[model samples]
Target: MTAAPDARSALRAATTPDHERVDAAFGAFDLTTREGYAAFLLGQAHAFLPIEAAIVAADPRDLLPDWPARRRGERLREDLSALGFPAPPTGDWAPFRHRADILGAIYVLEGSRLGGRMLARSVPADLPRSFIDTSDSVRWRYLIEVLDKLLVTDDQHTLAIDAARRAFALFEAGALRQKRTKAFG
Candidate 1:
């Protein structure tokens, strides 16, 4: 009999397309310039604030004890302020109804930190970078441990995958909205 896929692998496989879409959408921003960087942060704020708020409301502490330390919404806000841009209004996000759902969203948020490291190199050194500069491999490993431990059932795995996909979609929408406003141009 074939061994079952682990939670992380399953989620990655399921959401690869959505993840790619988000990467392409955000990749259009020219991060080397202040205008481009600020717009990119604004797009991130629009999606992250609402979703992170919802995750906090759900109280995932039982599943993720370090949830408080993992939040980056405030950091994103600080970057926006430093750029002289007002906080963009957050849009409505899908609710996190289950623990699996919360985990899925966390996956997207944490995974972004890996990508953020690469993007950070593009930003001018003088600019604020608290949000993207903070990438913790230990925290990521812990999250993977939790995901593998808790997402034991196929149903739970499915829920997590769906939630991750939705999170990616929210990010894509946020980037599109920012682009539409032409705030950076």
Candidate 2:
């Protein structure tokens, strides 16, 4: 182990590869089409709300004091309705048992906002794609700065890394589930 280890660094290092993988996988999804965007939002709602509920329940005010403003479940819901899609019932997710797990999940969730502007650009001018239209980066920057200061031990770092991986897998599964639904209908 290197000297002066930190949960921030350890978590980033562990998640870098996974982050890259998620970016590529998400990039492969074509959001230019109405059906594509609908499917995207469907899966997004499925994964995001459950994880958001878990972390919000974990009480993140200590770390992310602005959690309320940062929350996006409402926006996702609005987008779904704008597209005339019904919000389907999502299955239960295992609640995060540790603060580190919450942080890891939030890392994935918040990190996603950094790429939202690009996704927003992909939408047709006439379409309502507010879900990915986060043009400002202030919130994203704040989350990073706050995360950088939250001291986590090696054990916590490991758990955070695992949680981040699970977050990605959960999101992908949600998207796949939507695809299957579309195919079957």
Candidate 3:
């Protein structure tokens, strides 16, 4: 049997390997506190769900009844519009449509589990990576990585979730230390 692709490999395959751009985008956020990290994930979810929703719409069976995928996509698009993301009039979701099943799975496993609409709406365009022109392909790629871990793992400890939470905490701690050092120096 073929082994599932690793997260980075999946991302590289689904979207351009733009680590520099991704990191630069990530760097734009504070990521130094629980709220900051939560905001970051929600920002991703806010952007992520629209594409995810479309995929779900492509096949509604992928998610729980109330969490239809298409609605998720529409919501994401609506949220983006509400947040003033200028319409990418000519943007093509063909790439997204082609992989609807995979993207739908990602939405069910990742985007749906996030905080809530309020948190999502609270994420503004000025936030980190918020205006980096992220494509549905890139978002799907990232979501696949995150969701694959969250959904596929059998361990109840939720290694991926726990790791992500801890990683954010560590990042926040480091940011705090850096700030202190900068101030004291």
Candidate 4:
């Protein structure tokens, strides 16, 4: 028989590589100026809006009943508007129709909640930060407790991990695009 899936450890291991890529890409962005911050928010908007729609469209209710509360696209949109930038024109994602894949996508968003406080602190004093708030550790712990109980097969686990990688790739691509594009005033 196949080993029982360990969602927490599997997800942790799956996302770490892409996580490092995202961190490195983010580090390259100069966040000190209004334009730089706008670009950053725009990149986030590109990634989050599409990924959020995919997770919602996949109807993650079964796996994540609290999925609605977990979305951060609105926050990204708020940051975009505050920075006088329009939303990204694209809202497409890689094929993530399966519940496992979609939940994997959602996991990236949920996990990002952990870094909001530090990211919020990164903005300069004069920057807009309506969307940058502290991570809700209570909610994170609750999600983790739920995830720990899931019993996916190794194949399903692989789908979830692949989705996470795709999610990160989407974000990294958007960030790179932002670095090359014109910033909103």
> What TM-score goes with each of the models?
0.96, 0.86, 0.31, 0.88
- For residues 19-79, write the lDDT of model 4, one tens digit per residue: 9998777667667778878887887777878888877777777877877887777777777
lDDT by residue (tens digit), candidate 3, 92-129: 22233223234333443342334233333444445433
Top model by TM-score, which number? 1
lDDT comparison, 1 vs 2, better candidate:
1
Total residue pair clashes for candidate 3 = 7
Reference-based lDDT, each prediction: 0.90, 0.75, 0.38, 0.75
* Candidate 1 displacement at residue 126 in angstroms: 0.8
Sort the predicted structures by lDDT, highest score first.
1, 4, 2, 3
Whichever of 3 and 4 has more lDDT, that candidate is 4
Window of ten residues with lowest summed lDDT in model 2: 176-185
Report the lDDT of model 2 for residue 155. 71
**Root-mean-square deviation of Cα positions for candidate 3 versus the true structure, in angstroms:** 12.7
* Root-mean-square deviation per candidate: 1.2, 2.6, 12.7, 2.5
Task: Rank by TM-score, highest first.
Answer: 1, 4, 2, 3
Error of 3 at 72 (Å): 3.5
